[model samples]
Structures are given as structure tokens and as C-alpha cells.
Target: MSEQLKQQFTKRIVELQKRIDSIHHDFANGRHADWSEQAGERENDEVLNALESEAKIEIQQLSNAILRIDNDTYGYCGTCGEAINEQRLAVQPSATKCIKCAD
Candidate 1:
């Protein structure tokens, strides 16, 4: 991989990690607005929880990508051991499988 691409991926990973940390902080703080006394509070909490869960999954994927980069296996299909297409990686930096393998 080119230095520029590597930098971009690294930057994305850092941003994702920061977001994940923020989500963790929010969850840890038990952020709720008088839910016992307010209507729709449970729904709001559910939405926030769902968002946090999605962020966690994305963070896991990004972390794996960083590991692959460290292992010199980043742009390759995890299942078939083939080079992952650049376009796919550009669209989804956390992709673990090539198109065929993914299908």
C-alpha cells in the first residue's frame, strides 16, 4: 500500500476509535434525563443504545483492519487469501472478505 492510503486508513481508524470512546463514556455515565418522570424516555434510551451497539461493531471491524495492516494482510480477503479490490476497500475500509468470498 502507498504511504498516503495507509495514512488515510490510519486516520479513519483513529476517528472511529475516538467515536467509540465517546460512546463508551456516554454509556458509562448513565446518561438519562429523568426517565422515570418523562414519557418516551425508554424509547430514546433504546435508540441511543442501538446506536452505541452499531458503533461498537464498527469499532471492532476497524480494529481488525488495523491488526491486518500491522500483520501485512490488510487488503486481502480473509477467507480466500486473495487481494481485496481497492474500490471495495475505498468504500468499506473494514471489509474482511473480497466480493466473491463475501457473497
Candidate 2:
């Protein structure tokens, strides 16, 4: 089960990295000549920047979860030291805290 979770995390990490690379590509090489159109593009770029930041953070969290799995502490809550609920883990395998402590 832990191995399965590790594989799942690994897959998500790859997906996020791809998305980040695509975002960087967009940022580096595309723009309209007209100032007005460029302003609109800048707005879209800001949203992409936020998404890129979010993906980076999630990647780090998933990386941490992988470490926990290796250490045999994958299912335990980081804050309360309780076994994380199965349902919660199903929905969020990289979670570091149980529902109680998370709340």
C-alpha cells in the first residue's frame, strides 16, 4: 500500500513538473506587439505565475510525503501523531496532518 502511494506521488510529481515547464515556456517566449493586447496577456501571465507557484509547493509536499513513506511514517498525522483516516488519505495521499489537527 505504501509502495502504491509512492508510485502515485511519483506520477503526480512528473505531471506537475511538466506543467511547470510548459508555464515557463509560455513566460519566456510569447507576446503581442500592441500594448493593449500585451496588457491582457500580462493579466493571464499573472494567473499562470500563481499556478506555477502552487504546483511547486505541491511538488515539495509530495516529495516530503515520499520521504515519510520511506521512513514508514506515511499514514500518521504530522501534528497529532494519529493514524490519518483512510478516506482522507484516499482523497489526499500527500497530506501531512489528520482532519482533527488540520482543522
Score candidate 2 by lDDT: 0.94
- Candidate 2 — which residues are off by over 4 angstroms? none
lDDT computed for candidate 1? 0.78
Which stretches of model 1 miss by more than 4 angstroms? 1-37
Residue 8 CA displacement from its true place in model 1, Å: 4.2
How many steric clashes between backbone atoms does each model show?
Answer: 0, 0
Tens digit of per-residue lDDT, candidate 2, span 1-103 = 8888889899999999999999999988889899999999999999999999999999998999999999998999989899999999889878889999998
Best by lDDT: 2
C-alpha root-mean-square deviation, each candidate: 3.0, 1.0
**How would you encode candidate 1's per-residue C-alpha lDDT over 1-103 as one tens digit per residue?**
6456567766776776787677667657654477573456556657767876787787678777877888889899999999999999989988999999999
TM-score, candidate number 2: 0.93
